[model samples]
Target: MKRTDIDANVLIAAFQGEGEVCQRALRVLDDPDRKFVVSDYLRLEVLPKPTFHKKREEIEFMQAVFERAEHLDTSPTLTGRAYYGLEI
Candidate 1:
């Protein structure tokens, strides 16, 4: 299985985008070989605003993704090494 970490924008697009963009996003999300690893950062980025505004459908969609995915605890050191090439 391929371990994958989806971006917030891609998740949003899957939920709300149109045409090819939406199709591609959904395809990635639904791939059987994928094992999604998600972080609280992604939840924070995608969930609160929709929940606060009472967008129930959108919230449910995001929650469904969260439910099917593996939750990962992100650390500043790991993020720094991954994204910034920092020796930590």
Candidate 2:
């Protein structure tokens, strides 16, 4: 079985349910052969519980993923954004 780390954008896209993106996310997530994994850092980023009042459905979906998916190592902190060979 192949395992892959799921990014925040994929989860966000699925939650938002934007046309092609949502379809793609669902397809990958529904597949049984591929195993999807997330880190503690990513769990925090995409599944924040404090501000889901307006997106109850999204929160529920995200929670399901968080509960079902395999968790890896802790997420790394973003040191800085680099551009033009400089940290910005």
Candidate 3:
């Protein structure tokens, strides 16, 4: 599907360099075949906070990536509750 499901932390660390995990993810993302899969849920997870004060440009770039990537339906229900209208 030319898609990869990446964790929110990886995305955050790639730009902010908060941990080694982020460094590794950036290396993995260098492969031309990889594309991060996105959804409203992922957006909800990552886009809420500013990682730093002056990185709006970086944030906007990341937002553009999420905006253009393939989207997926989130888990329909978690435990017994529906999340994003999809069953977990």
Candidate 4:
């Protein structure tokens, strides 16, 4: 299967250890034939957890995901529009 873009909500659900969602995420991750694509913005949004103790494991797991997944760079035009309302 081609690489897929995993959304933030799915990551959140997996991190929170929701049984079904975690299982689903695991299935995807376990598929050797599949390529996973993740955006750098998504990584930045999900990596930081305010509650340190609860988030440590999640952060570790996400770091592992990052190691395995392809990260899509946010273009300057996109970043500028998102953060500074500047149209490129």
Candidate 5:
């Protein structure tokens, strides 16, 4: 099986439901050939705002993904390299 990391946009799209983009996002998540990988950064990116606003359904959706997917820690060095293209 291939391990795939889902971006915050994709997770948001999936939670949103309906439309072509949502359909596509669901397809990627539902693919049995792939294993989902999630990072602490992803949780921070998607969870905090919804949680603060009390978007219960959205929070639940994000929580479900975090619970089921393989968790990976986000390091400062890796984040700098990934986001800013800096060697850290």
Candidate 6:
């Protein structure tokens, strides 16, 4: 894949060991050639709840992942389009 759009469910499953899908997603994430993309909405969505007690760790993990991949900040225009099921 040229680039992959990561969603909150994928991240949640990967972290929580909910299923094999998450494990597979993590493997794909480990690929050096693959580009991971996430919007600001995804950042908010993937972030663990404050009461989870692992907020710092989760944030660190997300930071490290983004540091290795391309980051696309969500703008108002893009957000609006995305809401209507359009690709950014």
Q: Top model by lDDT, which number?
A: 1
lDDT of 2 by residue, 35-79 (tens): 888766675676544244456677678778877788876524441
Whole-model lDDT, candidate 2?
0.69
Using TM-score as the measure, which candidate wins?
1
- Using all chains and alpha carbons, the TM-scores for the candidates as numbered come to 0.81, 0.71, 0.62, 0.67, 0.78, 0.64
* Between candidates 1 and 4, the TM-score winner: 1
lDDT of 4: 0.69
Pairs in clash, predicted candidate 5: none
Worst 10 residues of 3 by lDDT: 79-88
lDDT of 6 by residue, 1-88 (tens): 5798877776666666546777886887777777888766875565536224556766777666667767786688865654553221
Q: How accurate is candidate 5 locally (lDDT)?
A: 0.81
| Two-way lDDT contest, 2 vs 5, winner | 5
lDDT of each: 0.85, 0.69, 0.65, 0.69, 0.81, 0.66
Clash pairs, candidate 3, are 75-86, 76-86, 76-87, 76-88, 77-86, 77-87, 77-88
Clashes of each: 0, 0, 7, 0, 0, 0
**Cα-based RMSD of the predictions, in order?**
7.6, 7.6, 6.4, 5.7, 6.5, 6.7
Clashes of 6: 0
Candidate 3 lDDT at 79 equals 21
Residue 66, model 5: lDDT of 80
